[model samples]
Target: MSAASPLRVVCLVPSWTETLIEAGVNVVGRTRYCVHPADRVSTIPVVGGTKDVNWEKVAAQTPDMVVFDQEENTQAMADSCPYPWVATNVTSVQAMPAALEQLAKALNCDALLHMAERYRAALAAPVSRSGRQLPLLSDKHNSSLSVLNDDRPLLYLIWRKPYMTVGTDTFIHSLFTHLGLPLITPGERYPEVDENWLVQHKPVLLCASEPYPFAGKLNAVKDELQLDALLIDGEPLCWYGIRSLRFLESLQSS
Candidate 1:
């Protein structure tokens, strides 16, 4: 008796693309937005973007599995998958491990679990410290978690030009909630807020590097809001996968 070989896959989610590549799986196609592992991603065939997936191109690849992020890919695309497909819904920082685990099991890949373990270990240690002390967000310490010790109110922005911000429904919101930070939103997803609003609330503002470039243009915010503004990498705050592990590692040194 012979077992079937591993399935060829197509990943519509950027995070899933990295995770599958890290697990040493054969990912035959990816959406245009799957740009992580920048050097290698370009060589892979592009099916389409998440919002406008090319089902015909994906079908031509004959991939055994098509992985899409629930939030990134439209439901219409998921319905069009002729082959076996999996939808990843890693919407919160806390759901990453479970999400990876499920995807691994779905594909019968043990390497994916190993990658998840690496992520868990990476987050559980301070890269410079004894490699045991967990930082702001840790699943290890439950009862006496230190994330709640700080009440530093902060607002994270994801977009500009009308000024959309982090809301309770987003992974970024969960990240701050785990860190016990006071997060304020305009009571709606992607609600518009201005500098005057920042002046009134007076919280540290973090400008993300994607969706809209916020650097150099925020000098006025620094002066007008009278607050500390940091332009940060948006991937860790948004994507919940291998890049996130790397992000946590960087935070250790920063």
Candidate 2:
């Protein structure tokens, strides 16, 4: 539907929720985790979360269409949706612009179409490294660890307590690949690792700041693992859609 005839949508993907709202789509419902554009999304009704959607609450919204992501919402949720639904599967940096274009076509939002074009242009621009290095340790830690410069293999951590990391197939891994960082993990989707695994692999560690609040426990994690670990922003690394465009732009300047 065009902006003149906007479709009432229930968006479950957090990143897409932000994109659709910014694109001026009529978002009637959203999951609890869709917390972007805080001023705008606060007014929308909640339909549970990415995995545990409240179908009844979603039905209450009486939305014209429901949005899902292949990596965020479950297949059963989409299959069980009583109303019309659409799902976007974006698994890499190269796939994001096309996904935005497809969504723009589906929603008939010119803003989204423009955003897709911007993403395309940003992706086409050459990335400038400028020799910027990410700090690997906090000031409190007395370690010889410094910022990363070389092409050493890195293992990015998303969760702890039986730590979890993304595989080569995930969107996060694709972003890492875009940054020219070599990943040491296997090809499987989110793989769980233990202290033993970390010791055996001995890859540089990067703890993401979301899905587990890794930033708060960075020191503890470093102490426990006895490995050089850095806290990273999870949003730019993992969140796709419009955020991906901004991320690409940032890389172009870097």
Candidate 3:
């Protein structure tokens, strides 16, 4: 398929959905979970969720391309896709600008070029002033909340049942590192932690709002941990792309 001005596309992940919309690409299909910039996807068809999409609905859309992520999507699922697909990986916050550039080229979306530029511009500000040591920044949008200081090692809780937390060397980890916080979990990727583990090794907890929203979901046990806890809007923190650049926060206290 010609990368230039694709007819229509299917987005299998949330960040990819945000990227495609920002790139001004025509997205005919999106997963039910792709809710970023909800105005753009309100009318779009739902193929399925990130892990399991309806191939028949996706094929019927006859999209020129399907965008998936190396992190959020599986290689097996990509192999089964009949349409031409663009796989993007924003491995780190430092690499995100370049990743945006690569995705634009793959989808032939010129609008996305601005996203890369925006990403670079965000990093050049307060982040650079701090000597780029990864000081955790306070959420710019949530101005009411005071800056956190007790950085006893922060934890990003993505799921509940199996108890999965964001692990080292991940995009989320990089974001936190860029913000200047230390992660306590020490596994390769997303690591599962049980209640015993949480109680034993209590870290500053950040419960994600998606992929299993944890705001009200885990409050009971979150209080039991007896550690500073906050609800992290997962989008700007974990989701890589234009949205992250826009949500680049300022540090109130490091």
For every candidate, C-alpha RMSD to the true structure in Å: 7.2, 2.5, 4.8
Clashing pairs in 1: none
Off by over 4 Å in 1: 1-5, 121-152, 180-182, 194-196, 220-228, 249-254
| Location of the lowest summed lDDT over 10 successive residues in candidate 1 | 130-139
lDDT of 3 by residue, 1-254 (tens): 33345668888988878777877788899998888788889989999988888899997898988888887788988999888888877678888888878777877766777778877877766643232333223443221233245435567778877768877778878877776665678486888987778777766666677777675655553545555666667777777776777667343223
Candidate 3 lDDT score relative to the true structure: 0.72
Clashing pairs in 2: 128-254
> How does model 1 fare in lDDT?
0.70
**Deviation in angstroms for 122 in model 2?**
1.7
Per TM-score, the best of the predicted structures is 2
The better-scoring model by TM-score among 1 and 2 is 2
lDDT of 2 by residue, 37-156 (tens): 899999999999999798899989989889899989899999999988889998888898888888887777888888888988887787644224332334454334444554555888
Residue-pair clashes per candidate: 0, 1, 5
TM-score of each: 0.80, 0.90, 0.82
Worst 10 residues of 3 by lDDT: 128-137
Model 1 residue 17 lDDT score:
90
lDDT of 1 by residue, 1-254 (tens): 11221779899988789878877778889988888888888889999998888878887888998888788889998887788888978667777778878888777788878767876765566444221222222222122322223354567767766667877777777765654453688765567778787767866566676767665556655565566656656776676787776666665566
Give candidate 2 regions above 4 Å deviation: 1-5, 129-145
Lowest-sum lDDT 10-residue window in model 2? 130-139
Best by lDDT: 2
